[model samples]
Target: LEIQKKGNEWAVVLDSKYNRRIDANTKMEVSGAAKKEVLKDKKFAYGTFANCANGQTPWGTYISCEENFDDYFGSSDENLKFDENFKRYGFKTKSEYGWEKFDERFDLAKNLDEANRFGWIVEINPFDAKSTPIKKTALGRFKHENAEFIVEKDGLVIVYMGDDEIDEFIYKFVSKHKYVKGGDTSKILDEGTLYVGQFNGNVGDFRGSGKWIALEYGKNGLDESKGFKSQADILINTRLAA
Candidate 1:
């Protein structure tokens, strides 16, 4: 939807692409991952649900977050084994919305990997109504609350986002490239490192500073031994990696 400011009045109206189905293209280039891992070749998904809160990018695009997405999916067959990853993400034999009963895509028994497709921040272009919504996988996937944009003095960006679950986690994505007005801002969200927030100093105390630990794949024991096969794996299983 677009909110336009007139002389003395503000007009809020539905956009041309309002209530549109999300494009299922996974444009991110994740290499050598299993075809059955998430979406086939980590390449596609159906649609978005539970989009609770949103934010805007410095480049003026809409950031829609998926929250409580696990509620849409469930296992029709309880005999189907669920892994630790599934438990961490809060998938279950039965979901709150029971969408699995109607949509096979929501059934974990049928499409287990489909769960991984959700829970990431989806970016939509306001300028191009026909634009495909890009899932920013560089930002770790979770039950996202909202992304707060922080523009560095030098034009780089730091995106702060919370997991939106009790005692979950907070993360920040720092961009490697700088943002230039009217210049290309593609890499600002695509190429970045994610860091989980670390709180220091406490014990019934109220105020303190917090440190950030990078959730990079090869750093601090996040290797194949721990089941992190690639950067995409780290991004998919962010909570466990953290």
Candidate 2:
């Protein structure tokens, strides 16, 4: 995109500028049944807010987490019944911002599925000013505190994240594909497996052994019998899935 200034206005010169293909494409194909209905085939959502922490990827992009995002959405209906999933995420009848009173998107009664759209880890290309951020749903949605990226010797990328809420959980995402240097890195983030952490030691042990529990669907009790229908369901209801 070549730009020219003309009389206090900016205009594109109709020139060609190749944009990077780094978007994770997790927007339209996101999780949550009701939330999917609201975002069906849509490439974009509202936005990411309440992000207080940040991270950097090995590909030189920036990672911004959506922390305390649940505070912006709430139920307007006084008699609205909160489901277990909603309760697990701590959605209340009132919110800190009270956006539900004015914005339909923030009102749970009017748009209950909207809450599911938030609480994600958003990736941004700092080099591209015109680039749009992508919400990496494979990383599992929650009140993200921070994300640390690591590229192993085998070229696999691992992202360790922490949920800010007390007594919540710690999670890590391992990419299914390997990272190719200077190669196409667009979909590497979307193709991965998220895992939960489990400590195995005494209560007073300072250093304890731990294991990474895979949160994939169909494994263990994560099948439909336990109310998890798909990988999307496990990722969406990460707290319960853990």
Best by TM-score: 1
lDDT for position 177 in model 2? 84
Model 1 C-alpha lDDT per residue in residues 74-100, reported as the tens digit of each score: 988977778878888888898999888
Off by over 4 Å in 1: 3-37, 41-43, 203-206
Predicted structure 2, TM vs. truth: 0.83
lDDT against the true structure, each candidate: 0.80, 0.79
What are the TM-scores, per candidate, against the unseen true structure? Answer: 0.87, 0.83
What is residue 50's positional error in candidate 2, in angstroms? 1.0
* Backbone atom clashes (below 3 Å) for every candidate: 0, 0
